[model samples]
Target: MTTLKALKGQHHVSAITANAMKNYEFYTKILGLRLVKKTVNQDDTSVYHLFFADERGNPGTDLTFFEIPRAGHTYYGSNSVSTTSLRVPKDASLEYWKNRFNEFEIEHDEISIVSGRATLAFRDFEGQRLALVSDENNVGVAGGKPWDKSPVALEHAIVGLGPVTLTVQNISALSSVLKDIMGYREKGKYEAEGHEVVVFETGEGGTGAEVHVVARPDLPAERPGRGSVHHVAFRVENQEELIKWANYLKELRIPNSGFVERYYFKSLYFREPNGILFELATDGPGFEGDEPFETLGENLSLPLYFEAQRKEIEAKLKPLDTREGGKN
Candidate 1:
């Protein structure tokens, strides 16, 4: 078995949202993540593509979305990303978030211990599920660079994305991809919402290193739309490593999008046996590829191919007001 030693942690989790402004406010104003990229989806030039992350838009911190109002509500079931978990400091930070969520009238669950870590689960404005998992070992926050201008105090600001839950009908097949191809190890298991959940961990077993799988044999397959996760990306070192991963996926006979250039990073996409989309993305040519780090997401950016239609694209996109507390 060829081991994916160059594979790092998660790159980003991409999902769909109906309202662009609502999604923007929730992630930026409410959650305090930096809007690292304001661009249009490469495939769909009209809809907005937004990326949020820690201060620098690091690989593991990214959570991206595509605004598609006409896509309608997501069908909940197997073969989908059920929830995304963000990392925060343990104890005090978790308390701070709970209070903050309360102050903002955000609905969230009481802190529950999952795999020995304190977790507070919540939903976004569009009903996209999310969770904040405390780094019980207190190591993940030490290196995190939070957005200084965020309303949330720097200390309590979310660090980055951690484990993301994938609901699958065929857990055994997906588990093989995580273990044999993606360099993840089975760490622990627990029951959640009546489903048996198995935990997997990658590099060093801390924040940004976990992926949870929930087996949902009784549920039907999901329909992708608003609130539906489009794909989950795993990080590779660079283009070289990305190509290696693409080759590996080919050898495994997994159908994949080979070596796609996404401007900011190169990507190779594939689906596991259960039809959940996954991507292996490189870390470099980061979010700052087009704009300087200081001005990231400050204005609209178009890919080279779409640059010709910038005027038309901008005209079609509904204005997004990211100003403090601005509502749509």
Candidate 2:
């Protein structure tokens, strides 16, 4: 029985999007995050899977989207990842974003202290729930480096992911999976809109690696579609450790997708007791493995298994011009 190292902080959050073109423009031009990977969803190659992140697409910085052109609206409710947080440099960054959001006519809330940090809640073009959290007091997991070329100034740019908010009806069950099985510890609690949000942290324990769970027993289970989160992945050291975790899940009779090779990084996918999809993924053999660092997201990238059908795949996907900056 090899003891696995504790899961590192948050890796990435995969969400659904109805329009990849607009998503690309909004994330890159407005948010100032780099388009790190331009690829198709492995499960369904007909659709695009875009990755946005800090300069290097570091493990903790990735925010991905799976384009489903005909996907329906997301009915807000329980048993879902309600809001995804992005980390900015410091507290003052919120002020810059507040004005930027106004200039772009992006719907947002006023800056306020939530879960002991300054946060600004905002929605994207399709109403994807998001928040910008300041790393002014973050001491645990360090944030990533923002791209110098981002339209947003370097001082106000988003660095990496912050705490993800999960809304569930059964908090006890989800808490057991996060604690007993995954080894996260409850840090504290805060109140928001008449609901209590319980904060949990793992690895080094900071904004970069926290999950804020709020019990919403009053609402129905979410009807997921575009603008909804697909899944939240936690960081693992490597494929070896990922395999160990797969075995551990099997030993405990927790059903999981055993050892999946995702090309860039290996993964193990499973559902928590509350039905939110969760993934454990390796941190290396990253985005740069298949594409060069200088021009990572300029073209459509595919795994070796799918390379043979590149022409067919390209035929199905609508053209998306990602070579906006010329070259990194």
Candidate 3:
């Protein structure tokens, strides 16, 4: 059975060029997320793997990165997949980001909300689309940390993904898949001209996050390339729940991308009925196992797999100073 006791909701990582330093500044100084891990890609030494998260760089709080220089700007069309929708606390902190965007000259727009919550939309240094949201509950970055000069008594940070959108040529086809096959319920419209935004909060949630899906009927097929979202992960309670999801996908004859070992997590990937890439990940032994909560994101840490080759990899990877992803 694919059921387990708990499932870590997400482990967000970026796919960008080799500008490691700029990312450091934006994530730490500007956005306020602590730099959890500094390491190079195990498979590709020339590239790096940077992790950012809450006080401890926990799985759900994490927004990781991959530096891939040669990758070009992603094309935004109908077929293009929806990547990440980040949630922020939604108060004066939003003003912080707004002014920060102005100060750093980061391009962004305020997202419209009906009866749900307030949201701000922006992109990462890598051009992957991202969102900042404020919802009913104020649960986020560990309290007592100073964000900006203000004593941000709450966690004003990237909590996790709000939702991933999928644009299908045939709306009805995707709709059926989401309903009959996937256990997703329709949330509501988040866009005026685009496809409807569908959502599904975790029935067995460990935190207070909601998944949103904004369908784009007017777009063309998306090509997977650099700076684009690799995939979106969904959370299950445990291994038993994971296998149950696998079996459910099997029942629909969906192809499993295979189980991937993310070190801190184990995940199974497959496209849902609407063609949105879905990952089922376990929650446990989070980022803390690699670094202490006190010193997370301050330095680089590598798994045993890449520890020996740090020197050689460091030479190939370029400094983020060369390519600044953030405006400021």
Candidate 4:
């Protein structure tokens, strides 16, 4: 078996949201993530595509969304990404977030230790599950860049993405895919909120490396809609690694969208055994590719191919209120 080498950590997590403004408020105002890009979905130009991240909009920091008002609520069940966890510095940092959430009236659970790390669970306005995991080991945070202007204190700002949890019908094949093909190793196991969970870690076993699988065979299959995760993307070093990943998938007889140029980064998408969508994306040619860093997210950005239709696309999108200095 060929051992995977290029896979690093999470590249970005993309999900669906019903309202662009609401999603923006939650991630930017509430969570204090930087609004890195304001664009439209490449495949569906009518809906807005938003990207939120830390200072530089680094690979692991990105959490993107597609706005589709009529998409309806998500049906959570087997083969769905259940939660996206953001990493915070240990104990003191978690305390800061707990107080911050309370001050803002954002609902969150009490801190609890899971898989040997303290975690604070919460959900966004649209009911998209999220959590804040305290990583005392520093994990991937040593290299994180914080947005200085964020409402939250610099020391306590969300460092980066932590482990993402997936609910699957069976863990067998998915476990093999993660371990063998994805280069993740089984770390530990624990029960969380009444469900049996298994932990898997990617490169170096830190913040962005964790992937939690929760077996839920009795639940119905998930139906995608608003607030559902569209796909969970893992990071590859660059385009070369992305292409290699695509070829590797084919060698394993796994069906995938080979070598997709996603504008910001190259990507390859494939569905795991339990139907959860996974993507391997490159790290370069980021948010600043279209707009200057200082003016990022100020105006709608379109790919080169869509430049000719910019006027039509902008006319269709609902006007966004980008005023700063207050919570929604």
Candidate 5:
């Protein structure tokens, strides 16, 4: 064991999008999140990798998307990161969002309580399943600051990410990876949508530092496509801690992507036993490292490795206007 520390909380959740323009509009305009990064998917430079987060693109606030134009609709099932949660300032914020969703004709469910928190579940234009979790009762893993210029009021704006829900066919298999390997402790269990949801939390347990797993053996394995989660990344301190984790995974004989540089942060990736992709990512050298805070995501950003190829990459990607004061 490296003996550094347990993983902090969720770093980010990356999903798939068929259209980056629409994804950008919906997340930044309707949902009121800031488009913190406009970059290409490092794995496949032909498409965009969009990051939406709180004002500063803080560690636990990012929700990213990789554009795959030809990707089909997702067939929801087991062995997937099913729902990504965003945190609001308080329980009352749920009512604000519910009304906002209705005004925009955005699909959403009524406010409901889960795991002792008020949550409102909704889908984006492409049916990306997401929920806004209330922080009225939250105690650990503090959320980030919402962008001041967001159309949504500051008091009701989303702060950071909340618990990500994982659906698996073999609960024990995933549980072992989360508990035995990742150091998440079983927080509690609750019944929802006809299944028993087991909650687990890592450092400083709260809404921001938890994962809710539910077994769905009755359903087939998920067919991933647009609107489906690609991976959920947990927080590590920095590159040094990330290196320790790489060594730790190596010592355990677990296959992993060793110490990958993401410009914004260092990363290591691996899949849990249930086949759901999980990542360990660092917290620093944030989004502002390259772009100024005033216009963070206004332009396309590229890592140094791709800067030489910028003209070619820019030609392949469709132009996305993320400048402030766009249509709301």
Candidate 6:
């Protein structure tokens, strides 16, 4: 089989959290992604499952959430297991995020470049490690970074993710998964923050092409708690493609890390023998199907299970802050 060259796109990366409302404010109000979908976890009701993404709620722009059951406080272990980094248009990083954070009074740390690009590092409301990188080759956004109060002109803000970091005890197993199953090509290796990080390039790396995997040797394993990465999703072409990878994992005898229908995509999950979790995600029938861009995340979008309770659903949902954030 020809080794996979690059990821098809990013569907959604999920995280477990304690407060669904808090997640809403941070991702939609603070980070500036649109709350494309809001509903309860079908697997378990009473727990909120949310999604945030770019203008049209495209597959690659998606970042998802799962409110865990009676979650406990979290701790950030040694090194970051995974960091969701978005690719921004060159020159938009400093002005855009700097002023945006300052205006909102959101605290963040600035890094010109940890490895190969100008990056601004910060934590989200959920304590997720995130970065905004001004990629030299960024193609910019179609709607011109539609979020509000950005220091840089909307024309040059982040279009979508540039890359990401995934931790593993050893690179051998995870690396093989990346090369054989995920279609990622090793870009090169670089030293940063006192650790050697390997970078992989996926797609054009801006829209559907932006995926990155790193072999984090020094990062300690993070216990799944209130605040931790629940999962990282790598996009595939469709359900058919998702099945092939799912069977491949089964053939490898990788345990229950297999495909599950996620409404929009199909997914398979497994941990590298070293204990790092990995997933193969698919993309289709994305967020726009439920809501328009101008009014996203402002209302409740439920699955068929909750269709009869739109009123109950809308009433139960916490009110969306009507305040137009200057820096969101």
lDDT of 4 by residue, 34-81 (tens): 888888998889999888888878889899999998988788888999
167-272: candidate 6 lDDT, tens digit per residue: 5666777677666656667767777665677766566544334434455556676666666777666667777777777666666666755667666556777765
Model 2, residue 270: displacement in angstroms?
0.3
- Give the alpha-carbon lDDT of every model: 0.83, 0.93, 0.56, 0.84, 0.92, 0.63
Relative to the unseen true structure, what is the C-alpha lDDT of residue 63 in candidate 1, on a scale of 0 to 100? 91
For each candidate in turn, give its C-alpha RMSD to the true structure in angstroms: 2.3, 1.3, 4.7, 1.9, 1.0, 3.9
Q: Please write out the lDDT profile of model 3 over residues 83-158, one tens digit for every residue.
A: 5555565555577677777777777887555326566778766666766766445443222122222222244655
lDDT of 6 at 56: 57
Candidate 2 global CA lDDT score: 0.93
TM-score of each: 0.94, 0.98, 0.77, 0.95, 0.98, 0.81
TM-score of 3: 0.77
Candidate 2 residues 233-328, lDDT tens each? 999999889989999999998999999988988999999988999999999888988888888788899999999999999999989999983222
Q: What is the C-alpha local distance difference test score of candidate 4?
A: 0.84
Q: Give the CA lDDT, 0 to 100, for residue 293 in model 2.
A: 83
lDDT of 1 by residue, 1-328 (tens): 4445646778899999998887888888889888888998988888899998888788889999999989787778888899999988666788898898999999899988876788999988777889998876744323357788777788778888888999999999999989877878998899888778999888656668778999988999998888789999988888887877878878888889999989888999989999998988888888776888777887898778778889899898998755342112
lDDT per residue (tens digit) for residues 1-328 in model 5: 6776889999999999999888988888888889888999998999899899999899999999999999999999999999999999889899999999999999999999998999999999888999999999899999999888888988999889999999999999999988989999999999998899999999998988999999999999999999899999999988998999999999999999999999899899999988888999999899988889889889999999999999999999888777862236
Best by lDDT: 2
Q: What is the lDDT of residue 142 in candidate 1?
A: 31
Model 1 scores a C-alpha lDDT of 0.83
Give the lDDT of residue 288 in candidate 3.
65
- At residue 200, give the lDDT of candidate 4: 89
Residue 134 lDDT (model 3): 65
